[model samples]
Target chain A: MPTIVVDVMPKPEILDPQGKAIAGALPRLGFTGFASVRQGRRFELTVDGEVTEDVLAQARKAAEELLSNPVIEDVVNVAVLTESAQNESQSA
Target chain B: MTAQNTELPLIGDYSTAGPVLTGARIGVVTFPGTLDDRDAARAVRLAGGEAVPLWHAEPDGAAALSSLDAVIIPGGFSYGDYLRAGAIARFAPLMDAIIAAAGGTAGNDAGLGGSAAGLPVLGICNGFQILTESHLLPGSMIKNESLKFLCQDQVLRVENNATAWTREFSAGEEITVPLKNQDGQYVADEKTLDRLEGEGLVTFRYVGGNPNGSRRDIAGITNAAGNVVGLMPHPEHAVEPGFGPDSAAGMRLGTDGLGIFTSVVASIAGGAQ
Candidate 1:
């Protein structure tokens, strides 16, 4: 199974008060490495069958039309994450 | 003051058309978790119009929608605000019917006739959000700037009187209505905002200032034909006195929102005549 991940984030010019609050509180908790933090929504969809280009195109359409609203947020990324790649990243 | 002419010439009897004027039947849709359908119905009735109930659960609502002169999508936390305030409600079956019936042009299955350009649809609060999600209207609503639920009597100015739901109001007239919601800040791209202003599609604007940080202080807007309207304030909540917001003169005389309902009814009646 291939995992289709869609990351939706507010436009760069828009305000992200929730993300700002989180970043402001992080330094107080002694986590000071990050310069900035912007929060966004992530959806991990597990699609059955082989991950083909057609499946990716369908996923992109869903992300563009339904999963993401162009008024305020931008669909930052829509990519397929396979199990082998997940395992490799986890092991490294 | 001089004596007034008690017998002003009454050209043609006003009562002659009494039998011909049937109350314009306005449909109010109710989705799961919707809170203001009853209020919207009452407002329609009080405005001398008939209120028809349309439910989202019933898939056959579109068939009956043809008889309606106009439709209203009231406010509430539909689908318990899941996946954002109105994202889920936008997919409701009745919403499909509304989108089809809107803009005076019948979609493939709308079954309605004639140009309903004068008055077609009005979406309030959560309904406004749903309209945006459905692409029936533009812009999107995010959380309040303060990240708090807002519940107050908001003042709005009539920015455009050409819209179906604002025909009864004068341009620049101020009206006070109840506005309560968690996610109400309206946002859109710069070009859209500019287009809205340039086209005079902005129906209502905040009188004092931006209440929920809506872009350009816009509280409500109409479509290109001025038939479909979407707004963040609860006009249905301020239709009656004593139970509504207080007036600026320290009185419980807040019926400013009634104009929206009456405006639709009047336009429908005028079109019929």
Candidate 2:
């Protein structure tokens, strides 16, 4: 079964307090040279069979309507998760 | 009056006073993790209206709302506040019906007029989040700027009293109510905020300092038609005399929040006239 991956992030104009707190903690934890940090969410939706355009379109609609709030967050990415990419993400 | 001499008013006390409207059917929606439905229903009963329970997952949203004169989406951590508060609950079947009945559409400007002209709806706290998520109201709620859960007796200025939920209040009336929430800060584009102010759609403004860093100290707002209103404060908690916030009159004697419920009933009654 193939999986659809949706990535969502707080809009740049909106304040990201969680990301700000993480960024503030980096130097205290001995991690240096990082300018800032922005946290986001990634959702993996499993499909029973081959990933099709229709399925991808439905996933996109879901991403816009449910996964990400267009008011404060943006749907950054919506794509099929290839096996190689999944392994790469796991290894990384 | 002394505390001992003050008679505590029980729920449905208005029935003995020859109730204004013959039990306006007000539906209170209960989403998973909702915390204030009971309080909201009590407020309705106290205001001389019948409280009807509506489930979020009701398959026939139209059928559920057909007989309802009004609906309330009370405060709570719906869906455990996952993936942003009220984000997932926005897609519930009941919300779809609410959006339609309140003259709203998904991802559309709330100012646009729709078919249903006057089904009164009030969303409080998490309910306000769902309204924004459903686009029945504009703007979104985020974490408090202090990054802490806020619970306080908040004072609010009634900016507009013509809305269906505020008809009992006079413009600029100050009322105190309990406000408790994590994601209570309301945010929106400057244009939208300006438009809300320009249109007199702002229903409530924090009288004291901004509690959650909400833009312009906005505590509540209503839609274009004035039938739908949303606020972050828990007015339902302040409807009862002994259980409400303190006021200059006496301790726990502030029933200012009752106006919201009474106002709706009055609006319904007036609409039928």
Candidate 3:
């Protein structure tokens, strides 16, 4: 099984209004989740390609090349999760 | 304000709406800080259609919608730039007119996916960023290149002039216009960029230099159906003659940004196709 995950952030040069609003609202919401909260999109997808290092590299490339904007933000990390780990997390 | 504000402009030119122009009625919305609505309106007028003014704060202004064929969200910092350039303005009453012009459908309903001529929505500069938040246009607009606000003329080669707003210009034609913004960078994923480029959706590409560091140096982009267009440059500022920036012709000339307004007017005159 193949797993795909991505996080998208507004480029550093670009200000994040949504993030600011969330950060400002955290105190009222009563969730001290962290010192600061940067908002972004997290997408979990399953691909059809066989799990390989090259495939992973290409996948990461695809993310940076088209999935995210290089000027304003950078991709934090790319990971491939196995079925058992996925199921363990899903079940629990 | 609604189109009934007779003090404002009417729909389409009173004269022959021009065979090529096609009598398309496009509403040019104006906010308090709207810096480019005048030019957008002129472009609509030059393109042989009536240019209507839609107010920024209108809970329900059906008159503006009922009298127009399409809408243009001109650029500017609405609400005095307190929250953000477009952050607070996104929830404005006038945008409802725009949302309605774009069919305001959650999905492809309201005839966007169907054969309906696809209500053309052009968002320039701050307007582009709003389109993203509004979920009308794809992608997002970020800060400028040098991290400092910039104001200068930029040249961009029309990559997909086939868009609903850019049909007057050729795909390869080079057009120079003003680009001034702090958070003007455009960011989207590589896959999305590839799809945009692969599918001929990349409308305009910055040439000479990437002033704002837009991803792929994309100056402008369009939605899947080519109806929605969003860009950073101020095309409205370039519409007037003897005004605008210095032209390549060596005089204080400017290319008529009228093509943007005209393209849609022509389409509408042809009966919304």
Candidate 4:
């Protein structure tokens, strides 16, 4: 099976309140040196067969039309992991 | 009279009487978590229009939206507001039909105009968010500036009296309505905001204080044809005077929001004349 992944994040100019709150708590929790924190969503899809270029394009379209909102967020990435690559990563 | 069937004159007539208006079928859409569909439907009835219930789960868009003179996407946490406030619900089959009816296509540049050009559609709260997501309207809503869910009786000034939803109010008239939400801060690119202003599309603006730090203090807006409108406050809740937000007089006498429902009915009725 091929693994497809999509990452959706708020536009850089838009405020991320939840991320900001988490960043604010980090200092009190003895964490340091992090410049900032931003939060986003990730969706994973496992195709039953080999993911072709068509599948990749369709995934991008799906992300744009459904998974993410263009007004406030960007679908930053849509990548397919081949079965061999997945197996390699798993083994390594 | 049986108590449940007893007619209580709590809702006052907000429209100017012309020819007797009747049987205008207004559809109110209900998503899984919709909290205000019943109130929206009741408001339609109070305005002398028939209320048709449209379900989000219903897949047949043609049959679901075939007879509506107007449609109201009432407020609620649809799809539990996953991803973004109105993100997931925007793809509901009914919304697809709404977008198609509103003259938008599946392609870019589709939302500018559509076949539903003259049809009246009003979106309140989450519905407003969905309209933006569907690109039926411009702009987007984000988390409130205070970083908390704010609920209150908000006063708004009617800024545009031309839209179907605000036809009953005069320019600069003030109305009190219940507003409640977390992700209610409306924002858009500066150009879109300016265009909305230049075109007189802003139908309502916050009065007294900006509740959620919305850009330009916008509470509501209409599309170019004045048929589609979206607003943050809950107009349906304020239709019945006894159970509505308090008026400027500090009494629970505000039925100002009823005008939004009655205005659309009157607009349709007037057009049919």
Candidate 5:
């Protein structure tokens, strides 16, 4: 089996209410450090077989169909890697 | 022990304690600025639903499991309130799982299919901010018309009172609750606002006055299906009658907040699936 991964996010243009809220609250908490907090989802999948983009696509399709709202949230970036490759990137 | 499940003792049975929330599995997602996760969980238990806490970074969304019946995105600052309120939270590991489970496969059912059917999702304050950012709700919350951080006990008129979360509220009934946010103003295009008003999509409205200058004095709104609800007021803060906001009539109201959680129980048990 191949591993499947899915990432979710609001279309870039769609304004993030939660992000704005935290942005507004940070100064009050005296912990304003970062510039922005763009909220989105990241999904990781691992299968028994090769983790091909095609397999990942299936998961993406499932996410688009059921998981994400294209009108407001959009899928931006995606990448597929073997367990070793994923580990390499993580270690690096 | 939840009010549902029927496993909990009805009247009194000291020897055999009941489940915490019975079997009403409820989920609470924590974003970076989320400050009310614990309060939300306690409110769920008071209303008889098991609270499942979800995190922004924790992967393996599989933990949501089939046992869950509803989910609550508690209020707080997620991701240090960087760009927008709920913007960063929308990308949390748990959101992907929720989106997949509830969004469902394209052809299956418009609503969440499979085990997520009748899954009631509620967003409060920052949670409400997340719902809009996540596209779970329409319209948006902007800077207060006054551009000031607003915190007050406000009165609101329950508008539709027909959602999975607001079923317990009487339509048009006025209730007081806390409103705290810098950007609580709700706005939308004329058409969308008109449709929302005409379609009875407005859930609750600011009672005495518009706290943050929301469109049409709107405090909350629900989806067409009524399973998903987003609001600016902190219903979770006013569960017990006396402990909650002052009831309209001035009685020793402890927890009106239970109604929100109880509404979830009603939605799952008596939803139009």
Candidate 6:
């Protein structure tokens, strides 16, 4: 089985209050490395069969139409998960 | 004038001596998490129209909409506000039918009738979210600037009274209705906002104060053809006296929201005539 990952983020022009709240909390917790933060969503779609160009295309379509709204958010990344990367994620 | 001397008309008052005009059949859609369909139906009935129940997952979308004089997408947390406020419900089969009938694109093809006005559709609250998600209306609803789920009686000034759902209101008339939602902030690009303002498509503007940080204090808007209207407030909740918000008339006596329901019924009846 394979997996397709879709990453969506709020548009730069849009206000991200949730992200800002998280960023504020991080500084209070003594982790002062990051200046700002923006929250986003990630979706992992499991494929039953082998990943192909057609599957990737379908994932991209879903990302644009369902996973993210073009008005306030941008579909930043849509890609297939490699076997090694999947293993690494599972182990971690 | 004293309360007793005032001649304010009671809400949902219809003369029994004359024949009731229940000819217009309006459909109220119920998505999985819809909470206001019953209220919407009651508003339609009070407005002298028959209310038809519509399911979001209706297999035969065309059949569900065929006999309806108008359709209302009421407010609710459809699909439990998953992904986004209305992202999932926007793809429902019934919404596809509504999109087609509203002269909006559904799935890739141009709208059914090629931008010509079709059915009259009103989206309230969550329904407004779905309309934007479906591209029937422009812009998107994000979390409120306050980052809280607000519930209150809101004041709105009608800017465009020619829309199907606002025919009973005069331009610049102020109305009071309930507004409750988490994702109610409306946003759009500057060009789109300018065009809406320029074309007089802005149907309602927040009057007293901005409730949710909506762009330009716009509380409602209508499509170019004026057949499709979307608003953040819940008019259905204020259609009946004693159940509505307080106003100068008396406590819980405000029926300003009834005008929206009656407007559509009158529009449909007038068209038939």
Q: Is candidate 5 or candidate 6 better by DockQ?
A: 6
* Error at B100, model 2, angstroms: 1.7
lDDT of each residue in A1-92, candidate 3, tens digit only: 57877776766645665576677789888987756666666656577878778878887886775555454467887888778878997899
Q: Lowest summed lDDT over 10 consecutive residues: which window, candidate 6 chain B?
A: B8-17
RMSD for each of the candidates = 10.2, 6.6, 12.4, 5.9, 9.8, 7.7
For candidate 3, write residues B143-174 as lDDT tens digits.
56456788888888888877778887877988
**CAPRI-style docking class of model 1 based on DockQ:** acceptable
Q: Is candidate 5 or candidate 6 better by TM-score?
A: 6
Q: TM-scores of the models, in the given order?
A: 0.86, 0.89, 0.67, 0.86, 0.66, 0.91
The alpha-carbon deviation from the true structure for residue B159 of candidate 1, after best TM-score superposition, in angstroms, is 0.7
> Which scores higher on TM-score, 3 or 5?
3
Per-residue lDDT for B160-241 in model 2, tens only? 9989999999989999999898998899989999999999999999987998889999999999989989999989999877
What's the true lDDT of residue B41 in model 3?
71
Looking at model 3, residue B103 earns an lDDT score of 52
Q: In order, what DockQ does each candidate have?
A: 0.49, 0.68, 0.05, 0.53, 0.05, 0.71
TM-score of chain B of each: 0.86, 0.89, 0.83, 0.87, 0.83, 0.90
Error of 3 at B49 (Å): 1.9
Per-residue alpha-carbon lDDT of candidate 1 for residues B74-97, written as tens digits (9 for 90 to 100):
898888988778888887767766
lDDT of 6 by residue, B96-123 (tens): 7888877776732633333244788999
Q: What is the TM-score of chain B in candidate 6?
A: 0.90
Model 1 quality (TM-score)? 0.86
* Better structure of 4 and 6 per lDDT: 6
Give me the displacement of residue B230 in model 4, in angstroms. Answer: 0.5
Q: What shift in Å separates residue B151 of candidate 6 from its native position after superposition?
A: 0.1
Count of steric clashes across candidates, in order: 0, 0, 14, 2, 60, 0
lDDT for A76 in candidate 3 is 80
| Model 4 lDDT per residue over B155-267, tens place | 99999999888889999999989999999999887898999999999989999999898999999998998888999999999987688888765577788889998998998
